[model samples]
Target: MNTTNLIATIALLACATGVFSHEKSPHHAPKAAPMKEQKEWGIAGDVKDVRRTIAIRMTDDMRFTPSAITVHEGETVRLRAQNKGKVLHEIVIGTQAELAQHAEMMKKFPAMEHDEPYMAHVRAGGQGDVVWHFNRPGSFDFACLIPGHYQAGMTGTITVLPRKP
Candidate 1:
């Protein structure tokens, strides 16, 4: 092949091998802040510190089972999330405003990629989990900020009550 054709062939092969692939899944999120960042919502939890386990099911109907969860302040809950639908799903933990903003960004950038300690992404019939520390007392949100998923109502609440004296 000519010099130009040879270079084009090499570039094509590289692309075919995913050498330049940057596409990402909707579950992709920004790097989670450090555990000691003192978030208004809470922090990532340690598996060993989990006080209990809870299940959150993602359905194709754009819903999450047990739409609300309650936890005590300073508690860590291990969440077992399952995608019972026929599509991809995820559970992203954040405040209502945060989730809403993330969802809007996801809608604009469908292929955004992110992985954090407080997010779980699963395929159809798949399962995932996250350990979260409810260190503060307030209401937070957990939603599937996967493109249209959050807009379709795949959101839940986490109510953290103050710890007893």
Candidate 2:
């Protein structure tokens, strides 16, 4: 081959070697093991009481199971929220705007007391209970206002239907 062709061939071989050398480097070594997936946990469901007590369970999937609840006006509801997860969760009962405002306030105050209506913030592997009386018939949302928990579908609907005459 000519001198120029020989040099060009040498340059191409050098480039190919450089590219293959990267695969043998330790920095490009395969990961020791695949990362384990993180588990997301959230509220379980909404409970209604025709008698007195209502039970709800929070799962470890960042969602409310029931997603909807129905109750009669003028009835007292005893809501039991159990966090069966590895993260903190809360149960807040209010309108959409009220819950939004409460979420904002929660951002300002992490340890703020939630005494309005009925609410509870439970830690991981903990449980909370709320006794609320629904005097009026309307639609309410039960949610968890822990940062991004609410937006993660950790909410339920409370439908307080009017009592029949």
Candidate 3:
């Protein structure tokens, strides 16, 4: 081959080698496995190791469906609340005094760190869950502390019964 042709051939070979070398390099790591999606919170109840799931839908109308619930004392309950309305809502479980304190704190702190053990706030188009263990046999009230939601009838009752022998 002539000098010019030899030079051209060497350049082409060098380009091919570079491309193949990149493909063979160990620097390119294999892609990681996709992460598992986080589970969304919802209402669930346990009975003898069997769990029953319930859906509580909230609306701008300011009401909770099946506004009454009955459970045995010392039972574990999982409540999933979904806001299907244009306004924010919450499901708070406490005594009359506790609820009052929560409302007052919410007013002052707004996004204050909630110390209540059984309360969940669900914003519009959002959902949340609350797991509660009823240890006492009494009438408990669940209400939304969203400004006027409670006054607008966004409240319900939970009756805990005595444990059966």
Q: Residue-wise lDDT of candidate 1 within 33-102, one digit each (tens)?
A: 6554466778888889987999888899999999999999999899999999999999999988888877
Cα miss at 46, model 2 (Å)? 19
Tens digits of per-residue lDDT for model 2, 83-145: 888988888877887778667655645664444336777778898887676777878888898
Taking all chains together, the TM-score of candidate 3 against the true structure is: 0.63
Task: Kindly list the per-residue Cα lDDT of model 3 for residues 1-165, writing each as its tens digit.
Answer: 667546645875686687689789989767564333221211233344334444678888989976788877657777788899987788887666666655654564455333333667888999887766665687877888877777678888788898887
Q: Write down the TM-score of every candidate.
A: 0.77, 0.64, 0.63
Candidate maximizing TM-score: 1
Flag regions of model 3 displaced more than 4 Å. Answer: 1-50
Higher lDDT: candidate 2 or 3?
2
Model 1 TM-score relative to the real fold: 0.77
RMSD of candidate 1 to the truth, in angstroms, is 10.8
Could you tell me how far off, in angstroms, the CA of residue 67 lies in candidate 1 after the best superposition? 0.5
Cα deviation at 122, candidate 3, in Å, is: 0.9
What Cα-based lDDT does every candidate model obtain? 0.84, 0.70, 0.68
Worst 10 residues of 3 by lDDT: 36-45
